[model samples]
Target chain A: GESVGLHLPTLSVQEGDNSIINCAYSNSASDYFIWYKQESGKGPQFIIDIRSNMDKRQGQRVTVLLNKTVKHLSLQIAATQPGDSAVYFCAENEGSSNTGKLIFGQGTTLQVKP
Target chain B: GAGVSQSPSNKVTEKGKDVELRCDPISGHTALYWYRQSLGQGLEFLIYFQGNSAPDKSGLPSDRFSAERTGGSVSTLTIQRTQQEDSAVYLCASSSMAGGSYEQYFGPGTRLTVT
Candidate 1:
């Protein structure tokens, strides 16, 4: 059974500090991976995504690193702020499937202290 | 310019009853997806519809769970004889198939409580 899991259930960081959330995936054939941020009472918002062909991808203030060898993924936030507090999830798309279904990992709740 | 929208932000139904959840995808989006998120849990794939093709329901938990997309626009997920374990937030997402993009925009999920 393919599964995605987070290494930590909760991460508390002081405001303006860098934060890193880790995820491990069981399936090596997953070609596309994404990081989503879900705020209270709101839907998950796309943060950053990386394809298997790429080792790292960066966005505005975030970065997603994919290590295909270890089947691990990570999301890094620079200068974390109070507004960055939310649950973060990592999802993978199986390479063999074209249906666009995603396998998600248990989320990591990020709490930013002021 | 609008994103995906779901009806009835919250739903409470008794066990053994049926409930229908609706989803409106973004305009011109050819792909729509349904997912379930339990408390403190990640999203679970439920069903997917692309254009006019047959929906991929492999992720549906059981026979009691079913969904349909009309005119390739809006979608409906219905649960029959719901159980307390069925309580969760149902999420809907839409993505444009153009250029083989896989980015999906999600809607505020409907929190379902089966009492």
Candidate 2:
């Protein structure tokens, strides 16, 4: 089963501040993980992805960290902007060779206070 | 098409009525997927079609829900004897299976409301 949040963790950061969204996955077999952003009325847009073999991966202004020991995944935004306010989702792929049957976690809404 | 597209952005139907939602994948994608997002349930995997074969249908909630992709391109999901529980945003996604990294491109989705 995927990770289900008992409560939607709220992350409120001022514009230009750094924001970190965390997720705890239950499947240790999960190796490929991706972070997606969904606006109010749109499908999720891929932000970044990281393979289990690496602990950290960086994108333009976002980063993904994989901690298999605790089965935790986290996304870090370098400098949060108003445009970054949206719901962030973490999707985990069981393995590298699977057909990409992803198990998604309950999303966390990032509110950037401008 | 430039990206995945779904027909009937929004649909409201009466209970026990039937409804069909359509999805047109990217021109060359060989793998297509269907997902459902209900009020409390996060996005859930409903079905998957690779090429013309669906190696997995384990995610479908009930026998009433069915999906198929024709010619490995366009696909449709039909709900029989619609119930209020079936109301949700049905999302369609596609990806190139041959490539090493599989990234699913998703459509805006069809919001179905059963009254």
Candidate 3:
């Protein structure tokens, strides 16, 4: 089981505002991390990923920050849009295991008010 | 299929009945996976398949749940004597290889409702 957990279960932000979601992971062996967005009645879509070697990675309007010392990871969305209203999940892939199995967090629901 | 595809977008069945969910992976994806999401919970890994080889079913909750991949393209997840607790959305994903943990495409998922 993955110790990855979100600090907030639900978040509400106004249109064009920034949204930040935080996560904590317990497994230090995990080398790969990913964030996914899931809409109602749909599967999760890959958003961004980061490796343990790096502290931050940016893609599109999203940024992922990893703090190995604190075992924390965060996803920051710049200018959060109404379409960004969905559940976001943080996942970890253990490098040592070499298995493709991903340990996923419960998820944080982001509700953007348009 | 261009991406992973699952059958019966939604299913409603009575308790004690059996159900089968299907998943069709991409053209050449060799690593297939099954997961279940209940309510507001995260996805729970159920099983993993690699080509025509054996599958890793350690994640299966019990023997009541079983899955099989045929000819390395399509797969089926069968549940026997289903209970109300089995109600949830079942998702399927496929990657390039079993060892490649990189980006995996997911299917729309099958929403199973047990009454």
Candidate 4:
């Protein structure tokens, strides 16, 4: 019954603009979260990750915000570029499980318009 | 410096045939994982292996699916009597449990098509 899901199936953004993708997770025991980007015909690439202890984590051009209260997670991309267009996924790991298995969300298609 | 690698970039097999997918994890990584990605869907966890511990077979979809990791390095996922619904991209990933980073580095994936 535990699952991760995205708020939007597709999100379009203008070049140079900022993009925000939202996700909602049903598991309260999830302590670790990760955001991944997948280009067409390629494997999912690690973008950023956040632990339950931290509310936010930042990477080069991306940031992941985790709201434990609402069981919500979001990925923010600054200065969205054509290269940023890809399907993004949010995944979570149950803290109590030592196996480190991850449950992934459906995915959000981020489309950048020039 | 090399990352995870999977073999036979793609495979097409007839229904009811058996297929084996291979994965090579990064050097020094003690954790290995297998996932399935259906078209337009997120990655589905299949199984995991850590050190010499028994694999966590909880994620395996059915008895027809089985995997083995040799010497804590190379891994092979075998699907017996595949069905059309088994068509998907199989991804392999590895992470270092030493640091507790849990960040899994993924391979390019083997696209399996059950015809």
Checking candidate 4 for backbone clashes, the offending pairs are none
Lowest summed lDDT across 10 adjacent residues in model 1 chain B is found at B95-104
Model 3 Cα lDDT, one tens digit per residue, B1-115: 3778899999999999999999999888888899999999999989998777689898899899999999988999999999999999999998884454566778999999999
- Ranking 3 against 4 by lDDT, winner: 4
1 against 2, candidate with superior TM-score: 1
Tens-digit per-residue lDDT, B1-115, candidate 2: 4999998899999999999999999999988889898753468989988875644788889999988788878999999999999999998988885645567888999999999
**Candidate achieving the largest DockQ:** 4
Runs in model 3 lying further than 4 Å from the true structure:
B98-101
Top model number, lDDT: 4
CAPRI-style quality class for the chain A–B interface of candidate 2: medium
Better DockQ candidate (1, 3): 1
lDDT of 2 by residue, A1-114 (tens): 545341355678999999999988887777788888878767778899888889999999998888899888889998899999988888887555478777777788889999
From the highest lDDT down, the ranking of the candidates is 4, 1, 3, 2
Q: Give the clashing residue pairs of candidate 1, or none.
A: none
Per-prediction TM-score = 0.97, 0.94, 0.95, 0.97
* Stretch of 10 with least lDDT, candidate 3 chain B: B96-105
| Tens-digit lDDT string for candidate 3 (A11-112) | 999999999999999999999899999999999999998889999999999999999999999999999998999999999875457566788899999999
Q: What is the alpha-carbon lDDT of model 4 when measured against the actual structure?
A: 0.93
Which CAPRI level is candidate 4? medium
